[model samples]
Target: MNTAAWSRIARRHPSAFLLAVQLLSLMVYPLFDGLPGGRLVFGAFGATALVLAVWVVNRSPAVNWVAWSLAIPALLCAVSAAVFRNQALLVTASLLEALLYFYAAGALILYMMNDNRVTADELFAAGATFTLLAWGFAYLFVVCQVWYPGSFSGAVEPERARTWLELLFLSFTNLAAVGLGDVLPLRSEARVLVMLEQFAGVGYVAVVVSRLIGLTILRQGRDS
Candidate 1:
């Protein structure tokens, strides 16, 4: 689509397109999980979606640097996986993805918190940030598995799709503080990371709720 089309959609709904892409990715990812080059394709799609989402939400030229930084590593990951055939490439990709989405989540959360009145855009941004947090932790778990063998009990082979999927499943469960016993963090560092993610999840809900309620009350008072 052209810039004009994107601009029109963004003006109509700031984060709706981004949220739809994310939901679509979540829904379709399982179909491609086992196929060759599937991860890279989805990674590229997700990176592009995230960059566009940030652009739609922020509309600042300064954020272009961040978008480019995120996109470059994703492109490198595709090339590295397809051409070089390196297992290390997955590790690099995971790290890059984790950092990029973490930054995106932070930016979105900051934007939501700074708004004087909560709008639909802010609500969508908040949801996006929550999803980004889950994704970031999933990638972080992948990195830990790469660095320290047997960091997770159920994920023996770090490079396989099954292991990656398991880590992602565990990441979301941990974020929700579900504590399902199927996957356990064996390493001290891994456990620490899980704990931190759990804390972050709780803290995020608290902060976001407080901010929204505070803003709503302030808006009502001003109108009164």
Candidate 2:
């Protein structure tokens, strides 16, 4: 094909990829509870990210090669998460996905850093919207279980109820990688999942935050 034809084929709209990401995320929200369904739910999350990566690799210009290289490992991690029935595997897969998303998010942010097509405020708003949407779905998953009864005890053998407050506290702890022992995961799967989340959480902070900090310091030095 001609060079012009190739260029046209490679430049897909970013919205197409983002929509795939959102659909995959929608599939993950319901599957957090300790059950067979939860496994499938999280599987979808990784799958969606994988699909987005593929689309990005095919379309994103000269950068497509680098994106493909990083995306291959990410998609493999997603496949591993999908195939493994172990709870730990699922959690690990998610942690990997979290890390992959961290990289993806950074790439997007850097792409927009100087572009006038979207304002920094607009980008921040978009990020917050996705975060809130994810949080809402996760909450609804728990509430629906409570509104109806669960296959397993919501809390534990002796405890009668599962509080959103407690779940939130643990979720943040997992995100922050500061595991306090009080809210331990009872199921083996949950434990595996938590460990993956913890690892991803720490690694993400280490990689992404440090990069952003360096960017800021460089910006300051340049300004001065």
Candidate 3:
């Protein structure tokens, strides 16, 4: 059904609904995948689906950006697939699905935090910690492809293994002077994701950081 139905079902059949979404989202990589243009159309729907889920389940701006941040890679894959008509996009598509699920779980964390007020330091710490962890994981994946070469499928043909990692890391990094040039996305699809993530990363920092910082400063001023 729709988001309302899914959220309600989540209350009673949470596991079932979660499993269904998660399972359906996963796709095979480096093979003959679906058409790119069609995938983009699907990506738009997926984005809407995710946003709806986030809105219906629990609307936290922080969590929304986090989920959108994750969605970037998948949307990139869909775009890449549609634009270039390549199968390599599926690899990143799978990555997006994983990110989506984790961010979706983040919603629950935000909900839990609602009960106990978390400080700015706490929020910053949590964000930074996750950012670092995500980067490390992405770094390892990219480095593996770089050093091993073909260790990951679609690393050579599309040659976007390192690039994917870079985009993924940028998605989590959230900074003004991001991108050190060590990881540059080469392919069309990877580049699309890089641009989108950079835009998103900047926007998230501007909005979330300012608000969070304002709240933190206010909290500290009040408490002090």
| The candidate that achieves the highest TM-score relative to the unseen native structure | 1
Where does model 2 exceed 4 Å of error? 1-13, 16-20, 31-38, 53-63, 86-95, 119-125, 128-224
For each candidate in the order shown, give its overall lDDT on alpha carbons: 0.74, 0.47, 0.47
Error of 3 at 161 (Å): 4.6
What is the per-residue lDDT of model 1 for residues 117-206, given as tens digits with 9 covering 90 to 100? 778777777777777788889889988977887778863544343366687788788877766746788889899989999998899888
Q: What's the distance in Å from true for residue 14, model 2? A: 2.3
Please provide, for model 2 over 34-104, each residue's C-alpha lDDT reduced to its tens digit, 9 standing for 90 to 100: 66666466556546655564454343232555555555665665566556745444344444444444444
Instruction: Candidate 1: list runs displaced more than 4 Å.
Output: 1-7, 53-57, 60-64, 155-162, 217-224
Total clashes in model 3, counting residue pairs 3 or more apart in sequence or in different chains? 3
Lowest-sum lDDT 10-residue window in model 3? 23-32
TM-score of model 3 (CA atoms): 0.38
Candidate with more favorable, higher lDDT: 1 or 2:
1
TM-score of 1: 0.81
TM-score of each: 0.81, 0.42, 0.38
